[model samples]
Target: MTKLAHHLGCFLREHLPHERGASANTCDTYAYAFQLLICFAAKRMHTQPSLLEIDQVDAPLILAFLDHLENVRRCSPRTRNARLAAIKSFFRYLEYHDVSCLDQARRIQSYR
Candidate 1:
């Protein structure tokens, strides 16, 4: 289940279009968000993002990513918060749908 990219991409292509009529922009946004997530998690695990394991990403890692987005990326707080919101929502959806992300869903509550 560590293949978040393949899983998410398949899920989106198969279900999202039918369930929510997802737009191209929405798909692309989610893709980029996950890319950033993987990179951030990889940095925490001291490896290249492509070598990251999904288990390396937890609550603290997510917070660090948000911080990096705000401080290093120089993104506005509002934008950072919005991306966090989106990430939280995605995990929530994953958990609710019996996806293998329940261990990470609780981190959403820690998000501001």
Candidate 2:
């Protein structure tokens, strides 16, 4: 584990106060989504979350993570899509911050 999860957690806890106000369940689900992605990324890199860079996380990895969520985690299709949406929202946050990823985000848009 690294600060990445902490940072994401903080983002949800502090910045997105509206999430709890609006839908705590959705916020919790999104938090799980972030946890799943970052944990998977860290595992793949064999490093901590703080060590994970935008380049190390590409579309393939993200897709693999999603597939794992479905097959391994046994998440429903609706849950998978919601998780994917959370992931896409995360990337959009990265993009907003001018983080140019090595992987094109659009290429990873597949449930299969």
Candidate 3:
């Protein structure tokens, strides 16, 4: 598996559950957020989600994804913000485990 896939698996399976003690509903919501994001990124990049790299999910793509959620998907601002929060949380998780993505994580987190 790619680094993105591996880390994502670990984040959802290990970190969110055991380490962070997130509830099942929260985990489910976060998973759904990523499901949408992975599909969006894959379609935009003309690649399969499994083939996507962590670096490809930059601030620009993230901003575009948020826009897509609000406009094309017709999601409410609350839903859009929730999805963004989920993405930001994932990047925060990456901050310590993947030092190479620290800058990218910060950029995503700082987006307002």
Residue runs of model 2 more than 4 Å from their true location after superposition: 1-15, 18-22, 106-112
- Please tell me which predicted candidate would have the highest lDDT against the true structure: 3
Order of candidate numbers by TM-score, starting with the best: 3, 1, 2
Tens-digit lDDT track of model 3 for 1-112: 1368889989999999899999999999999999999999999999999989999999999999999999999999999999999899999999999999998999999987
> Once all C-alphas are superposed, what RMSD does model 1 give against the true structure?
2.6
Mind sharing the TM-score for model 3?
Answer: 0.96
Candidate 3 whole-model C-alpha lDDT, 0 to 1: 0.93
lDDT of 3 at 43: 100
In model 1, the Cα lDDT at residue 22 comes to 79
Instruction: Output candidate 3 Cα RMSD.
Output: 1.4
lDDT of each: 0.70, 0.67, 0.93
lDDT, residue 41, model 1: 76
RMSD for all candidates, in order, please: 2.6, 3.9, 1.4
Candidate 2: what lDDT? 0.67
Provide the global lDDT of candidate 1 against the true structure.
0.70
Summarize candidate 2's per-residue lDDT along 31-109 as a digit string, tens digits: 8887778888889889987777655667888778878988998989888888888777655554544444314445553
